[model samples]
Target: METLFWLEDSIVGMTVSSTQWGYPIVLSLHAIGMGTLVGVALMLTIRVLGFAPAIPVTSMAPYWRVALGGFFLNLLSGSALFCGNASELFFNWAFRIKIVLVLVGLALTWWLVQICVKRSDQISPAHRILAALAMVTWLSAIIFGRLIGYWS
Candidate 1:
């Protein structure tokens, strides 16, 4: 609690919280990152789940680079966004849920990537499950993230 309050009161937080454009800019970045991350994840997951059998999963390999970039961008922007309201976010149940979902989503995305790298021809049942889980995790994270504002 003390640490969160300290972060909320820190220079970075103050700038984000007080500046008229700062919060919005950071938030917009976060949204862009989210779109990239979730959109690419969904596309890959759909391939793994055998939606578009014509497109080889390996062909989607380049997307992982884009997804990783999005993840890093989200990490940076989300951290700044969190800093702006650390005290409240730290105590928000929805925020915690969002974090967990994102972590799980990341793990699932990793597994999906591994599957793609190994056997892009015919995906196994496990790969399909992981792909489905990834979709659910990402979507749930988005839902929980949206709920954070209402909850806090």
Candidate 2:
């Protein structure tokens, strides 16, 4: 408790929490990061699932760059947000769930990337299943992220 309060009182935390536009600006970046992360993820997953047969799966590979950019952006912005409300967020169930989901989702995405890097012409059942799971995990993270605001 004392630690959280201390963290919340830190310079970065105070700026995010007390400044008129600081929180909103960080939040907007977070939202854009989420959109970039999930949007690129869905594009790759759907392509793997054969949504657009004309576009080769290898072509979709480059989009992972955008996803990674979004992930790092979110990491920075989310940390700032967490600092601003450390005690409340740390104790929030929804925040906990969101963190877990995001971790799992990122792990699954890494696995999917490994599979893609192999560049197999044939899409295995395992590859399809992994892609599907990644999509679901990311979407669930988004849902729980929103729930954190409402439930916390």
Candidate 3:
């Protein structure tokens, strides 16, 4: 494997020399996106869990939209950050683990969305169970993402 570290020196140079504060700006958005992604995801899951019947299931669609928005925000920011620290990330085992978790979480989230749409007419219990699982997957992904930085 190439290790994808071919540009480490250049990436490090750019990352460390951001007079325009691009890194901080991207990081800030990434953080905000993460908060929205995890927060809204959990809230919707709880709604599906029946915390608020006032919230029509269709309302959750907006949250799903926000979730997608978060996904793009994080995708861009995370990719740039990753490119900027390829060497460090490549060596960080915790980061590797976090990446795997995130992949699984995203796949599960997509599946959850599909199921929710198809079973819109299904009763609450089954919906609640799947939503609960989605919540767990998202929560675990976020926790592991944090652990990557802390542990590495």
For all candidates in order, the CA lDDT equals 0.90, 0.87, 0.70
In model 2, state the lDDT of residue 43: 79
Error of 2 at 25 (Å): 0.1
Per-residue lDDT for 88-128 in model 1, tens only?
A: 89989999999999999988898888777555576889888
Give the Å shift of residue 49 in candidate 2: 1.3
- Spell out the clash pairs found in candidate 3: none
**What is the Cα root-mean-square deviation between model 2 and the actual structure?**
1.2
TM-score of each: 0.95, 0.94, 0.79
List clashing residue pairs in candidate 2. Answer: none
| Prediction-by-prediction clash tally | 0, 0, 0
lDDT of 2 at 36: 94
Query: Model 3, stretches more than 4 Å misplaced?
Result: 1-3, 10-13, 16-20, 117-121
State how far residue 108 of model 3 sits from its true place (Å): 2.3
**Which candidate wins on TM-score?**
1
